[model samples]
Target: MANRFLAGYHAAFNQYGIWLSVPGVDVTASGPAANFLLRPDFKCEQIIISGRVAVAAGFNVDVMLPITVPTKRPYVQFGVAQSGVGQYPHDLSMIGTTAQIECIGGCLFRSDRLTFSNSNASGFTFYYDYLVFQRGIN
Candidate 1:
């Protein structure tokens, strides 16, 4: 309940970008869209972000955070992309359907619209910002 109060206050007072995301698309998130597996859900997920810059293709993570074990900064992990890899929608995707995947940049998503630039592996079909959240007590 305290967390809720804090979040509500922060959201109203802070000047940041808010986006919805798929649960487990990382460790802690909301979830995916309904029937998202079929089509590219035109739902704009809100994300709370600050100033964003662009980075070249690679592991150009904007920020690396320390992921704690529900307390006392247990383990170091990550947070949001400090820089924006993609600015416009067209920059990130070619078409709603499958395009010629050039970069096999690992399993970033589970859909056909999403592809890589030049990779040796296409592990998963990235449909959206898909991820498996840590359920129950980890």
Candidate 2:
């Protein structure tokens, strides 16, 4: 009946895999950039994050993948932010970053603060999609 169908759907969803998308991790003119933290229950060997970085002039943006461990936490640098065009041109750009980690859970994404303090740019937005793959599921 209906109960059986619901059970089957839930089983398939959990067994197959899971994906999450976080939009508009924004950084603004005032200050304070956005930070993203994945769930602690996340257990996977590899993770792929693809996103777009958009910002106004006078600011530089960079992406970093920070892996958590028992001692001595380190970060893997993706790339430095590129020079943005003026407001009129609309210099929105796309960035794709990936990280490979040991069989662990919980990860974080951090955007670098203002590289240049002169420009009065409006803001920045990082749209990211994260995918987690089980060890043998592919």
Candidate 3:
């Protein structure tokens, strides 16, 4: 049984070694900004920013980032989800309530701040998660 297990382990190691020895296959999990693939045109610094904001009804708020945005208009991929009892981008008149939440702009990114606009007459807490990619600079 020990010999059989040794043989299986050896076979698995050989397969993994062959896969790792491939030219463009990278599986190094070195750092936060490490590229797991060998794509030359896909090397860019990225930062994940996430937060929650409570906006008053019919008001807008600007949330500051911990790090400065690399450019005036960097590539910001973001998502915002409503947490409170409100329907976003749709009128809640069918439910007999006028509380409709509107994201004024999908996601606005400035140099070092993110503007969140809530156009609802009822307050809501928004949870946002985004990835900021550094472009045009190595």
Candidate 4:
């Protein structure tokens, strides 16, 4: 389950009521934002990722694929990091998508490094529930 409630990610909006009317005429704009249900695809961004995973048992591993982030002002990539044994959850903030891509499966191959860069850079901003994978992960 996502942690939107815990993070208070609920929409923030403004409400306005128009004045001046004959008697019972009133109009309001932009009411309370509605809460939405998260979809399965939302759990893990349906990004096309391929990469190799190695196990000590000498078992055949698979590379899901690769995801290349387009370097823009804020370059972000989201996807499920497959693990052999367990499932990983996604951040609530990540669910509220700010970008839409029609071709979700695997993106057309591109260079590894991103090209989008901005000037007067102060710092980078990332929104997500950051957690360490593990200690043995090298």
Name the best candidate (by TM-score): 3
Residue pairs in collision within model 3: none
For model 3, residues 22-90, the per-residue Cα lDDT tens digits are 233233222222322322123454333554555555666787766553433446665555644334332
TM-score of 4: 0.16
lDDT of 1 by residue, 41-120 (tens): 24232222122223234432222211212221111111222223433322344334354554433322121111222222
Per-residue alpha-carbon lDDT of model 2 for 1-138, expressed as tens digits? Answer: 111111011122333222221344321111121221222124443332323344334444443423222232222223223333322222234234243212111124333221212143344322222232223222
**In model 4, what are the clashing residue pairs, if there are any?**
49-64, 49-65, 50-64, 50-65, 50-66, 51-63, 51-64, 51-65, 71-116
Alpha carbon deviation, residue 93, candidate 4 (Å): 24
Candidate 4 residues 27-115, lDDT tens each?
12112223323221123222222222222221222222232223311122433211232223333433445653221121122333221
Candidate 4 RMSD to the correct structure: 19.5
Model 3 residue 21 CA deviation in Å:
27
**Number of clashing pairs, model 3?**
0
Model 1 quality (TM-score) = 0.22
lDDT at position 101, candidate 1: 51
TM, every model: 0.22, 0.19, 0.42, 0.16
Each model's lDDT comes to: 0.25, 0.27, 0.44, 0.24
Instruction: Compute the lDDT of residue 38 as modeled in candidate 2.
Output: 28
